[model samples]
Target: MYAWAARWRNAQRPKDQRLRDAERSGRPPDQRDQITQKLTALMSTTPTAHGYRHPNWTTPLLVAHLAREHQLEVSARTVRRALHGLGYRWKRPRFVLSRRDPNLRQAKGSSRGD
Candidate 1:
């Protein structure tokens, strides 16, 4: 249809006369790169190392940290999307109690009736 006709018309034009891709219209590209680099650098280390009281990173915490440390304002959802694009995955930390107490099982059993 229209596309075929347009392609046929384009084929007839000289190589240099052909239409080029439209320039992207939006925020400048460098801003995105700067944000991405800052995010990646932040992710490479623990929050505590950066003077954040938290032991690990959360989406909201990351947003606040970015604004505070890097002066980059972004939303938690944006942070999550950036993290996803960078191939990072979130997993919960596992906690296991050590078997240092011999009476641990007995104490738990005794408490069950209450």
Candidate 2:
């Protein structure tokens, strides 16, 4: 309860530092489309030094990675927006559960269940 109260108090305080930091940057941000295009071309043909490690930096992978890695600058939501503009949709394999198998997610449990 103490920790929760402390977190709640912190959340109530306005984000002054973040606003100041943004003002300090003093420039408009780069366009994601341009960045995506550049990153896509570079990854598709060019052999980057880091390419050995980041081999699967394709268009989708690039978006996904940026969405994960540079989360502050590039979020998964923004990546989804970009992908949608490029006529792409996020799809992951869904498990085909047996009819008898119960869904654990729908089960009632405490927050500590995971």
| TM-score for each candidate, following the candidate numbering | 0.58, 0.31
lDDT of 2 at 104: 43
- Provide the lDDT at 6 for model 1: 76
Tens-place lDDT digits, model 2, residues 51-106: 43543334455655454545435555665566566665556546686676465475
Candidate 1 structure quality by residue, lDDT tens digits, 7-58: 5578777666555544788775545677789888988999999888988889
Candidate 2 global TM-score? 0.31
In order, candidate lDDTs are: 0.80, 0.53
Leading candidate by TM-score: 1
How good is model 1 by TM-score? 0.58
Q: For candidate 1, what is the lDDT? A: 0.80
Clashing pairs in 1: none
